[model samples]
Target: MFGPRRAVFLDRDGVLVVPQFREGRSFAPTTLAEFAIYPDAPSCVARLKEAGFFTVVVSNQPDVGAGRTAREIVDEMSLRLRHAMPLDAIKICCHTSQCACRKPQPGMLLEAARELKLDLKESFMVGDRGSDIEAGAAAGCRTVFIDLGYTAEPPPERPNKIVGSFREAADWILSLPQEDS
Candidate 1:
């Protein structure tokens, strides 16, 4: 019998979309107007899907908990992301760092694995931040860090691979050995 399917988990802002910047600070989009997807995002997602991996998105949106962005706007941004890519699922943690679902905690990836019946050991998580790497590592998934020279400190746990763009990340994931059916 086949075991759980392999999946590629992605981080939304900074990884899938062009992160918004305000006063030299990086931030997720607070409104639909501020949301902008990277040009390569669709193609990158499509490549992963075509390689027979389920594509999922795991994101941390702490602004919602901080009351800097409305839940409605977050939902709208999620809708746009889904419309823009062929993701199998998108798991969002709208809570603060204390929440278990937040990145660096692995709750989102773990929940996605449970819901999607994914083999975490055979899966991969790609992101731009250290928390994303830590989350993927904690969840037992290999990680790919898209290095965009962000100012944030590195993740405590190192990712399996570090690349310059999502395209490179897709290439790396596609090159991995396929899991047994």
Candidate 2:
């Protein structure tokens, strides 16, 4: 029988839309007006889908608890995201860092794996921060770091690949040998 499908888990904010930072902390962007898609996101995702890979997004948004943004705002932003690039599934950690679901914890990735029956070995993560890479690595998925220049703590672990943008990451994937299937 076929095992779980390969997937590409992407990061929101700096990877998808513009990250809203306030008071030296990350904030959930408040509106569609505030959310801007990175130039290559739409096409990058399309290529991944075309490549026979399940595309998911795993994000950490602690805005409500951090008081940096509201839950409504975050929800609204998600709606906008769906309208924009759209993913097969989106898994997010709305709670604070201590929550098991938060990135750097691997709970979200674990949950996605359980719910979707994903093949961790065949999956990869493309994100902008250390947490995104760490989370993917912890879950045994290959990781790619998108260097969009967020000022978070340095990644304790190195990702399997580091690219400047989503387009580049997609290109890397497409350029790989086709034996992956």
Candidate 3:
């Protein structure tokens, strides 16, 4: 792996699909029936693939640890997401705020960088939350924050770019200077 490939690390819940909302808060789908892939997500991922980027999904599913959802359901969702899109890998953290692999920690992204032989500097992380941006920055990847207007608080850290949807995120990544292998 002398010349590592660049990756686009995606957050699953809000970035790939419409998150389930209740009482003004967003939650992951706990069941296969509730999993809904956004209309543009498949094409957005396809575009990233076409642009020579390895697309990986890094997600936090804390409900499983909290007993709000089952691990099987979470696994099912991951399977469905991978089946629906052109993802190279899916990394999930199911622990409730106590694990290093969760968003805001960069463990998952770091793991992917190691396992996939990725160049973090040439990578981009796309997510709709501050934790996602923080994790990407910690992992030394450029961050793309998808602003869905769900939070009043500013991002935990500044992102390299902020866009309104996954489509725009992919476009931004494509616009960057291509890294020479």
Best by lDDT: 3
lDDT of each: 0.86, 0.77, 0.88
**Cα RMSD of predicted structure 1:** 1.8
- Expressed as tens digits, the lDDT of each residue in 1-181 for candidate 3 is 3345989999998899789876555678887788899999999999988877889999999989999899998888888888888899999898886578988999999999999889899899999888999999999999999988775556546788989899899888888778564
Q: What lDDT score is found at residue 68 in candidate 3? A: 88
Summarize candidate 1's per-residue lDDT along 10-77 as a digit string, tens digits. Answer: 99988898888655436788878788999999999998887778899898898998899998888888
Stronger candidate by lDDT (1 vs 2) = 1
Q: Candidate 2, TM-score vs. the true structure?
A: 0.86
For candidate 1, give the lDDT.
0.86
Model 2 gets an lDDT of: 0.77
Predictions ranked by lDDT, top down? 3, 1, 2
Q: Model 2: per-residue lDDT, tens digit, 62-100?
A: 766777767777777777677777477888787865777
Show model 2 residue runs off by greater than 4 Å.
Answer: 1-4, 21-28, 150-152, 178-181
* Residue 61 shift from truth in candidate 3, angstroms: 0.3
TM-score of every model versus the real structure: 0.92, 0.86, 0.93
Ranking by TM-score: 3, 1, 2
